[model samples]
Target: MASWQEIEREFAEFAAKVRARFDAGTNKTIATVRRDGAPRISGTELKFEGGEVTFGMMDGSMKLLDVRRDPRIAVHSPTLEPPADDPGSWPGDAKLAGAAVEVEESPDSPVPGAGYFRIDVTEVSLTYLGVPADHLVIESWDAAKGYRRRVRK
Candidate 1:
């Protein structure tokens, strides 16, 4: 797994694009494993600070409990449709997959039992569709493989 800092250091340009997409909106989506091993989706807010991706959850929240029991997580940037007049202008969608590690809460934590987690990214990807006329593009980065690009019609 790699930290956000490591991803930025190795794939600076791509990382920037991904970060921009993630920051384009206030709410993001996170996927976690439920106790029955089924997938659970939750709305979340993300913080990219101090070269780390962090998030908080209310105490005893199901999502928080899920992460506590199983740290694996996948976070998706908010989805935005491309304008009809400017298909290529869309920022595309970004995804980050990793394991969450519980971290100590700051003194200013809003909730008494709020849980904080730092994401240790294992994979990051951006996907663009219909950007270059009937083509789809995907760019991905990983700790072991660095960066890769793929295209489809």
Candidate 2:
């Protein structure tokens, strides 16, 4: 896994784009695993600051409980549809998958008594459609491989 600081340093431009997508909206989607192993999706707001991606939930929130049991998580950036006049104008979608570590709430935390988590990213990806000759472009960054690109027609 890599720290958000590392991602920023290594993939500056790409990271900027991804961060823009996240900043473009207030709510994003987070996927967690239930005790019975089924997937649960929740609406969440995250902060990408102080070299980490962090989020908090109301005390005893189900999603908070879910993360406490299993830290593994996947976060999807808010969806941004392509402009009506230009299908290729879409900025793309971003995803981050990793394990979250429970942390003590900070004084500045959004919810005073909320549970807090700091994400340790294992994978980060951005997907853009109809790019460079009608192909789909997928770019990703990982701790082991650093950076990679894949495309499909």
Candidate 3:
């Protein structure tokens, strides 16, 4: 098993991979749960700066509303490979969950629903070709920065 620090490093590396694959385009998806218990999922651009994941939304978007009402989210990265209709030969996918908070918008940015929502990721699970791995439970989170490795009991 990897130590907490090593796991953090792996997460950072994985973030870099995601950024390279999606940050420049529109491929990432954001899923938020509403206070009324509805689930809202939509594609959004993901930006990583100084190790924090930032995603933007229009002020009036349902996702934004959902996050505001219930600031919990699950972000998913679908299998990169083309999905096979058959259950076999499928690629892996990744998902992370955490608490979310609204971020102040940039004064100069003109994107309409340009406000950001930052998620303080608390749990992460990686599925390799549909095999679920052990869940990583976050011991602590920092929205201003990121997460610190938790000491193993």
Candidate 4:
């Protein structure tokens, strides 16, 4: 169990790392499931506001449509880079993953071609990219399985 302050601090640090990566020109992938249950993926810029992560999407876009139709979404910051010398070399960057439930919908969206959608995040997980790996945090809704971490290697 982590304290609120501690969790807040962790999120701040995590957010900074994400911001830096994006600033340096790394694009993240947003994954969402449709009402019919098919997975949809799109590449986009992600912005973090305090603990909230926002996504800007186009109007009439399939991804946006899916999100509107089904708010349940899983946004991941996947490892887009491979190990340098060792195949197992870990970067130690934090990856945030979890469910994002729309909390607000704007009349105007920053997404490439139109309207905006804002969401109140229900669950989130943080994983540190490193060997002897450590999952810094896991937070989720009770009905949604919350957050859990498992190291692959």
Candidate 5:
């Protein structure tokens, strides 16, 4: 796992693309595991600060409970539609998977008294149309292997 700062320094170009996509909008999707071993998706807003990716959950919320029990988590960047006239112009989307380490609320806690956790990122990826707009491209990075790009028809 790597901290956001580490990603920034190690994969500056890829990290910038991921951050831009995440910053493009507010509401992101978060996936957590439930007690019954099922998956739960929840609307959430992510925070980037002090070189850390963090988020808060309403006190006693199902998401909070899930995080407490199983820190494994995944976050999807806000979505944006490709322009009708230029499908290839779409900025693409980002997703990150990691373990959410419980942390004490920071002094500037966006939601005071809420549950807080910091993401120890295991992987980050972005997907978009290739230059020709006829195929799909996926760029992914992990702590162990660094970076890789794959294309699909």
Candidate 6:
């Protein structure tokens, strides 16, 4: 498990690009595992605080409860349709997958008693159209392998 800052330190440019994509829009998506071992997707927003990738869930919210029972989760940054006229201009979208660690009323908690957690990020990725707007490019970073890139036609 690595903090967002660790990624930034190791891959500053890639981290900045991912952060910019996340900040460019709102209503990121979250994926959590239900008690039944099923998958759940929900709308959420993220807060980048003190090098932690964090977010909040309303008390008793299903998503919150899901994470409480199973901390494994994945988050996707807000996405946009690439301009048809200039696909090359697309900045790409970001995604992070990891375990959600409860803060337990930490000082950084935005609201008292609210369910807040930071991602112990296991992986982070960015996907976009490549140069010449021909192939698709995927960049990924993980705890074990560090960073990797692949191009798809």
- Model 1 TM-score? 0.94
CA-lDDT, candidates in order? 0.91, 0.88, 0.58, 0.52, 0.93, 0.90
Candidate 5: stretches off by over 4 Å:
110-113
TM-score of each: 0.94, 0.93, 0.61, 0.59, 0.95, 0.94
Off by over 4 Å in 2: 110-113, 130-133
lDDT of 6 by residue, 24-114 (tens): 8879999999889999999999988789998888887999899989999999999898998888998889999999999766565566557
lDDT of 3 by residue, 1-153 (tens): 222233356566644443444433457677889767978889876655545666778878888788878888877764366345643343345566677767778554657665676667765554333222223322323344454433222
> Over the stretch 63-88, how does candidate 1's per-residue lDDT look in tens digits?
99999999999999998998799787
Question: Clash pairs of candidate 1?
Answer: none
RMSD of 2: 1.6
Residue 19 of model 2 has an lDDT of 86
Return the top candidate by lDDT. Answer: 5
Q: Give the per-residue lDDT of model 4 (tens digit) for 1-153.
A: 332233346565544554454444457777778777988888866665545566676677788777767776655564446466553444333444444445445434434455354445544444444543333323222225533445543
Task: Give the runs in model 3 whose Cα sits over 4 Å from its true position.
Answer: 1-25, 82-91, 107-113, 130-153
- List pairs with backbone clashes in candidate 4: 102-119, 103-119, 103-120, 109-115, 109-116
Top of the candidates by TM-score:
5
At residue 24, candidate 1 shows an lDDT of 93
Off by over 4 Å in 6: 106-112
Better structure of 4 and 6 per lDDT: 6
Cα deviation of 118 in candidate 6 (Å)? 0.6
Q: For candidate 3, report its TM-score.
A: 0.61
Q: What are the per-residue Cα lDDT tens digits for candidate 2 across 1-153?
A: 877888998889988877888888999999999999999999999999898898887888889899999999999999988777877888789999899898887678567657888899998999887554378888898777888989988
Clash pairs (backbone) in predicted model 5: none
Clash pairs (backbone) in predicted model 6:
none
